[model samples]
Target: MDKLRDFLKSWPGRILLILCLSPLALLGIESYFHSGVDPNQIAQVGDASVSLNEYQSAVNNRRSEILENLEDASLLNEDVLHEQVLRGLVDRALLEQQAKKLGMTVSDDTINRLLREEAIFKDENGNFSNDLFATFLRQRGMTKDQLFAEFRNQLSLDQLNASIVGTAIYPMKAINQLIDLQLESRKVWLHRFNWQDYQQQVTVNDADVKAYYEANKKSLKSPAMVDLAYIELTPEMIKVNEVTQQEIDAQYQSFKQELGLSDDRQISQILLTGSDAKARADAIKARLDKGESFAALAKAESDDPSGESGGAIGQFNPAVFGGDAAAVEQALSGLKVNQASKPVKTQFGYQIFMVTSEGSSQVPSLASVRDEMVKRTKAYKQQTLFADKVTAINDLAADGFGIEDIASQENVPLKRIKNYQQDNNTSALSQPAVIKQAFDEFVIQDQSVTTAIDTGKSTVWVQPSRYRPAKTLSLTEATVKITQVLKQQKASALALKAAKDMAAKIKTEADINKQGISFQALGDTNRQSPLLSDKERSLAFSQPAPKNGVAAMASQTEMGATLIVGDAIKTQQQSQLSAIEKAQTAAIIRDNLGQDQLQDYLEYLRVIHKVEVNDANMASAQGR
Candidate 1:
């Protein structure tokens, strides 16, 4: 069980965890909209009924993970995979029931701890926030209570599984054996018998070639290939009307509203200060009311620092004015362009204000924004059209319409792709998701249209139009290959005989120097030696300890044969096992043994409580 848990904690396990927790569980993106399966009962374990929706969700999740990692997408079409996924769900249901029978429970405190410890639910200060946790649950279509309930149930099941497999105590003898195997090294004297020497002298004739071709023709064939008819819809394929005058006007209004602009004024003010500032301000306003220029009045008689530059202040809204400015705001709002106001008291001081510039916020005209509006309108319409078409196509497919029928009704062109194979592909349908759907059991065997598959950039529907089975190669076409094969076979036979003769001579003489064979001495080589083939190295280890440094025996490799004379098997002393190494080895042993124990317990539970599945309902569930 520890081994299984460790595996689940790895990259693949994390992916599975995400799937189980994610809303709709690996029905992929398109499934987010129409992921529901029928809720009818499909299987039973003891008193528990596994619903069609639940089984389908499990299968979809597991299948998605397998297809993502597996190099060949075609394997997704296998019925055995469907069976395995269903069985896994059934087993899980059985285990849950067993856990309940044993009265396993997870406390509320434990649940709270789990939620608090989850880093995703934390704020910048690393404290758990109820708002963030609630938001997370809401996004995944779950209420806080529902998520906690499920999490509690999961914890109970985990405890149950863990309890069945106690800490494993691996036998000392087995541990020693594994340790020795890992550390052992060998010193060897090796001999080589090269097959290339015999290859140059071997001869093949036309009859031999013909016989070889006749015997092996069936094995030389191409894999099964398929041709496809598919309808693909992308944003680029959407055609909509050009931007009209009305559309541009509406968009401009929307843009203006989004910007939230307001009318603003640019002001110039001469602030007066000191004990008699109010009186001074009133006198300044009187002078401004006269024919005196405001800038000249500000430059000569103003008491504030801004008086030097005619008291100019940049354009701003009333809200942008700072401090106890209620009176200033009211005064500024009433003034017109190029108009002066009476003295107004402010946080800084009493001031006389003039409005130099005023403007109302307005949207840009059509001509100035024509090109950008056209682009945005086009993109918006295309997206709307693409989404509508995708929905329509999916609806039609669900209603028993073929892709061709949908294409015709929706005014989309149906394109055909030829010679599609698992590895050799040339179409956009070559995408793994497309390939998986095209070869799905229902798509090929039952002749059904696939569910609308969104490929991020495009949505696609596939129908298999033609299927070709693999066929044997003709003898006439295989002659050249057969000739080479025959020569290799004859050469290998001759080489084997030579090797045997050489081995016999070496054993009798107890020496490797004879029969034109050259030997190299490898000192203290381990199993991972790059100089030798895996088979050769393993064979060297199997040889008995050398008798007075003589070659033990000879063995065969793929392309050649060899003999090894071993000096001794060198291994680490038992006391040399480091503390960390011992702990790691013990953990591995425990995990291995624990896994076996868990499997046995699960099997025992299955027999004690009879489990049943309905095949007919399973098939019907898949059809949905």
Candidate 2:
């Protein structure tokens, strides 16, 4: 019994010691078992415990950080929130995996040093301040120990990342090739032919026209379309109770009071501190005193950012000027025109004040604003009428009234479109919504009356006049296009020959410069320039000798220059050299052309790994 009492007495002291050392003991235990713990596991990898509450807290902090960084709060949406959270979790999981694979570790000393150096945790003296650190952690909803753990995990992952990707260097040959391709430039002259110039070339004979019509029977067919007359409803269309003259006068009085003319100021200032403020201010004052122009003086000397505009602050309601109700009343009390006051200090720093003008706070007469009021009243009435009419039309349509019957009953005009198809693109019925609704199988199959379809700012009613099916192009229709193509080819050949003849006329370097026929110095540009077609760019950089010095000829297209390199230019060109090298390069090119190769690589990696997404949880987190 004596021993038991002794033990009970010691137990209290032992409990106090345990409580004092609990946090450190827990941290030590965590470090010892860290290797066996999988950070990626939401509920601890091995025997460690990652509480759901802890993960949620971290997610919320991350979300808050993102929201704080955005310039516009309205742009935040469910998709953006979901994407950010998922990305953050994925990154965390990836880092955890990487850290474990590399046997990476971070110590408490490292995290402490980082915290001390972090600007967010520093004091005015530029040293680590515990108070600041605590405040920051509190604001972010994180504890010091939790932050340190995250930092440690991050550091280990960073080391692993460096091992896998940081030290890998690209081959010099590859870099050089990329740079050379980027810098390459092509030389050519352009010749343009406008379609308008060839309008006279297009002629239609009666037989030809008939043949064309026959061949393009599908195009000749009219589209199915219907004209719509419907009423629109809007707030402006509704009538409201009339506002009386007395009410108008009251509104105007309120406006005048809100303007605060008696308290309004148009004062100028001379900054007496910082970077020649006093000198500038004095110069401005001298100008103002000399009557050299208040605007000019303000522009030259006033420190107000907008002083250039004659120190104008623009008209504002008193509430917006920091002179709220009380300040407005105080400033207005017994104020006189052109009166100046001693410098006053406010939240926006010191300022001198002057009452440029003063007037009684009285509303304008109703006669002065009657026209505006009348316009508003009429608009309201129209809106109400329009809304009622639209509702009537919708009701009629719902009750199986055809557009023709509705138009007749409404006493409105009826229009018609003939032979319309879903793919028909006539300007008359080219509205996307109209096209979609008109072509819907349900609408066409039942010949059902459709609800009014909104075409942007207006609504329309549509009915099919005719429907056409797909058909093959006829020889007669193709002939004219083929002939036009052949003619263009001939013209192009002539233009090229003329260009070549002009180039051949140049002999000496002096002549080349004198005539300003400079060979375009190649810069690093790849084959992507719309300025150069693929064939032209390829020819410009191709190898092998033709009978002539030119590898091929390059000419200008309607858009830009085209190049056709001669054997001479080909000999000087540098890209993939010899036949063997060219063949190897072509293989690499083929590899790049395989569009799905990268996607397939990613899919393979995904299949080899385990990935589980708690979509419902994610959606809930995003407020979706």
Candidate 3:
């Protein structure tokens, strides 16, 4: 399932799935072109122009992805999304031009290889199926050539980026310095001065708060609120009759066939990689032919992480391995029980496998899987009823039925919420789809009934009854909040002053306990995560062995201030940078450098090609 989801999120996934979020690898979009007539251009990049239709397609794809991921569609700011989309498209065009100039190309073989490796287009046996691939294209109204072209362009961009990043290297000296700070740890004596302790030292009169309120009155505006009357439709509200025995029997058979109840296999194997993997695999196979124990040799010589378990890779549904599934299945297909196969080449390298067991796939009797099936069928029937009920309720609303009137006709209770503000996100009406409809300009201005809003699991229809514009709050309404704010500020200031005084005492070697401040020992903590606040942690690391070895430092926390006396400090050794860490650090440095280079190249393209953005058209496209 994860593999399928990942495939749906990739370049091909975006093309096949409706949730395409980015236009970074916009390959075959040129296929959307109309008959050789002049098209309205949105932007010009050198000699190439972005058609308005192309930009809209990209924007809509990205918008759909966003709405699917977020709960509240109203949270999407059209202006911001439009700006990002246009910028991304412009950058994509620039990179494409640069790729052409550099003569970088992606071959047809690479595109074919990538598609074959895609998990979603594969059968249950992990083998690529042309039928599944064609189905995906047909569903999205695309052709094979169109998607393949997009893949080629995407691969070219990836190669270009890789070439730029490959040349970047981080100096060992800088890396060592970073390792020291990153791994350093400290043990300390800490003291916290609570702000609540200083509450008695401060006094705030009504006059101060009133004066502060008067000066900030214009800025202290109340959020606009609305009153709503809505209909809530859920699957649980519908009653479902019994599912027929014929329907149950048919569904059970379908499930069994879909789940491949005719075949099953239990396999165990050893995987080996590296330049000598083939030779090593051949050697392993030779040992097996000579009757060497498979598990014993696997435990001794295999490189796979599962080698520790005597190479028990476990049973899989064969169809789960998309890339090299076929080669593996083919090798095992001819092997008898307890028989080992010769070394087989796969994407993960050479592997020697043993078929531990084989049998017909198991199918449970109807009695064994019936209870669960009955519950599922009931829910399915209920959902169908719910959908019909919602449509009827919506029809009533469209025919000038008020929420209460609709509720009476449908025999469902109506819910009304008054003075609802958007910021009260905890409210039921604050649900994404409902909030989007409730606050819609047309819904509020024309008092129109919103289209059925699906909140993923439920459906809601909201109509605004009363709307209130945001305005300055009255003194009576804001007085209590202002008083609390003033009190907190006064307490914090007094606490900060007291903390500074205590810090001075600690530096002078005075007993903190005597001054009524209890101290606790914090042992061996890195600045990245400490018992103290971030500021205090940073201050502890910065203090220079404390003057005369007194070993003390001071910093502030959210509640008040803190003083710490370092008991011991442990610095990470440069020798601790393992080979794996070195490679990881180098990769991080290379990636950052690659991004910087890409940004600079894009800027250079903009200057040379004289890129022009059409703000008017962009605004129109965003439906501003």
On lDDT, the leading prediction is 3
* Runs of candidate 2 exceeding 4 Å displacement: 1-92, 185-530, 533-539, 544-548, 553-563, 566-605, 613-624
lDDT of 1 by residue, 249-283 (tens): 45544554577854356788888888998988888
- Residue 522 in candidate 3, Cα distance off native in Å: 2.9
Candidate no. 2 TM-score: 0.38
RMSD after CA superposition, every candidate: 12.8, 19.4, 18.0
Backbone clashes counted, model 3: 3
Query: How far out, in Å, is residue 370 in model 1?
Result: 20
Candidate 3 stretches with Cα past 4 Å from truth are 1-86, 98-170, 194-200, 204-219, 261-368, 397-400, 472-483, 508-512, 530-536, 547-551, 596-624
> Which is better, 1 or 3, measured by lDDT?
3
- Best-first order by TM-score: 3, 1, 2
The clash count for each model shown is: 2, 41, 3
Model 2 per-residue lDDT tens digits across residues 1-624: 453244234522232222222212211111111334343434432223333343455455544555568653323443444454444444444446546756899889866765555554456677877897687668757777766665566566556544544344445467446545645553333223333344344544456645555665565433443333233223443446576544443344354456562323343332334555545445544554555655555566556775666555543244544533333333333434444333344444444444454434433333555576455545545665666767777788789787778878865556665545445467555665576666656666656666776554455566553444445446565566545544454455555555555545443323334434435534433456565556556655554334423233435455323433323321125543665665565555544544234334334434544555555554445433
lDDT of 3 by residue, 376-404 (tens): 67776777788789888778777877777
lDDT score, candidate 2: 0.48
